[model samples]
Target: MPQETNIPNKSILTPFNVVAGIIILAGLVITVLRFTKGLGAVTNLDDNNPWGIWIGFDLLCGVALAAGGYVTSAACYIFGLKRYHSAVRPAILTAFLGYALVVLALHYDVGRPWRLPYPIFLSPGTTSLLYEVGLCVFLYLAVLFIEYSPAALEWLGLKKVRNLIVRMTLVLTIFGVVLSTLHQSSLGALFMIAPSKLHPLWYSNYLPVYFFISSIFAGLSMVIFEGTLAHRFLHHKMDATHLRESEGVALGFSKAASFVMMGYLSVKLIGISVDNNWHLLFTGWGLWFLLELIGFVALPAFLYSLAVRERNLRWARWAAALSVLGVVLNRLNISVVAFNWYLPSAQRYVPSWMEIGTSIFIVTLGVVIYRFITTRMPIFYEHPDFRHDI
Candidate 1:
């Protein structure tokens, strides 16, 4: 038998799990109350604001957060930055969870979420950006499941299948990267159609480009953030080599993020200046725009540079985390905040307790699945000599 033992001895009652469970339960209860009543019963949404926090945070923000899977996999498999090999599995897993959550959140908001599949098969719309995103995301999700299958294979003691999946990983990875690039940019394209409705400050012809570039940082940042969480909570599940490998991935990601941020900053400056939208800077939204830029973009880019130069992985991790937050804010601004700029702030979509609860429940479910897979699979740590010569 291969050299192996069961996972570390830790009770399932870790504080994190307990807290997550409560949040989920509370959210579900709220959801039950909403369906029995109506959207008006629990939600603050009205005709003025059709979308709410579920669309802003869970769908838009969550997709950006999930960008890590594509970025890391691209670096390793496409770019052949082999030092980042260790980060690939976790990034893919996170992407799966992040997108999965978006689906769940949208399910709650749609008229008939159960009929979602109908759009895919029965009433497909090829020209719709949302349709493209939907198709691309669905295909990408399948790619992720395929890429992540080795973990399940290992858990089931199917060594042959695990080896086969690893061998075919290059093809699957290439497919995943292409789909991710398309869908991510398509997400930005979704807002582009609402150019007249979006705030003049954020809307531009280069929206797709900004969205794509920002997603690079978002993915990198998510990898760092999620890695920190897992390492802290699953201390006993870690090993020295795994930590060392992950550090290299972090450093590489930080440098890449810095470069991407520099490009993004240039576009923001050029976009606003060329269009003479400087007047918007004097309004309330302008202050928020400035805050988001300085707080999330400029600050984190500088910190990433400092961290990389100083070889300070800790600060780099924090910077990556901040970059991820910036990405989240940027996406939400496009989708919801800037979508209906003329609407009163009070009239904006506000999530009901049910919406919040369901979002939490979906995320918790993802965490549980991630934990369950990591506990028994080869997703986290792989033996250095375990290379398949396929």
Candidate 2:
């Protein structure tokens, strides 16, 4: 008989869970306040700065970090890297949840949240880049759900459906890669219309390329980060096979991230050279840009090489953390900081308490949901009955 467990252990009201509960409650209250009182009431947004943390951090960073699903799946299934098969399901679940939370954040950012679905059925703006982003996000969310459904079906003892979904892994992985490529690049394309609005230090005609390439490393780093945490905290739930190869998997991910980071650094420098903005490195923002590139990108790449060469999983985990931070900082720099770099301090956007609280709430909610699913489903490891195949 297959074992089924929900809530995992008896001690549910731990300190972490208590804090998460408070944040979730506060977030729900803030969300209601946002919808009822209007965007102006709970936000610091204005004519000069319409979007805030929700869009910059939650949507942009959220989507980019969630790239683990496609990256791992493509490696395991499409490229026939069977060694990485154990990591695929967890990556997919993370991606699914990450995208779902992005949709929630988008709802708070858009002025008319109710009209979000209008793009799909009622008012199709076929020519807009936003339309493509919206359509791809909607469709890809469905694809992720479908990709992850087999795990849930297996948990529920639906063997027939679980096997059926497992067979579609290749097709689903290919489709996911295509959609992720388009939308990930399109995110950078979103800022192309604002050439003057973006700082020369960051803007480029090759923004789309930067986004796509960096996402590969970003996904790899996330896999390392998430996998490290899982192994430390969820050891009991993980299979022995997964536990044994986990270090090797982390090393492989770090090696790949190192290579991608090198390419990203080269391209970024080339972007600066092409714009003849090398002189900007002397200015404050220019120095910040250099810090991001060298400290975050170059330094981490070097550390990853060291970690892999020495077989230091600890150092690899550190590199992954830095890499994830670098990715988030890059997104925030582009969307929030550089977007209004030329504007005066008085005219620039700053998030209000309500806005900050709401962002916290949304993030907390995602964490809670992740916990719920991991505890209930066969995410950390395969169920015994479903062990022969994923």
- Residues 310-340, candidate 1: write the lDDT tens digits: 9898999889878878887887787777778
Q: Looking at candidate 1, what is the lDDT of residue 145?
A: 83
Best by TM-score: 2
Per-model TM-score on C-alpha atoms: 0.91, 0.96
The 10 consecutive residues of candidate 1 with the worst lDDT sum are: 1-10
Name model 2 segments beyond 4 Å from true: 1-10
Residue 235 in model 1: shift from native, Å?
A: 2.8
lDDT by residue (1-390, candidate 2, tens digit) is: 123343454367788888998888888888888889989889999988877888888888898999999999999888887788888888999999999999989998898978999999899998887898899989999999999998799789999988998898889999999999998888888888889888988899888888888888999999999998887777788887788768878998889899989998888888888889989889999989988888888989999999999999999999999999999999889888889889999999888988889878877887778777887888877788988775
**lDDT, candidates in the order shown:** 0.81, 0.88
Off by over 4 Å in 1: 1-12, 383-390
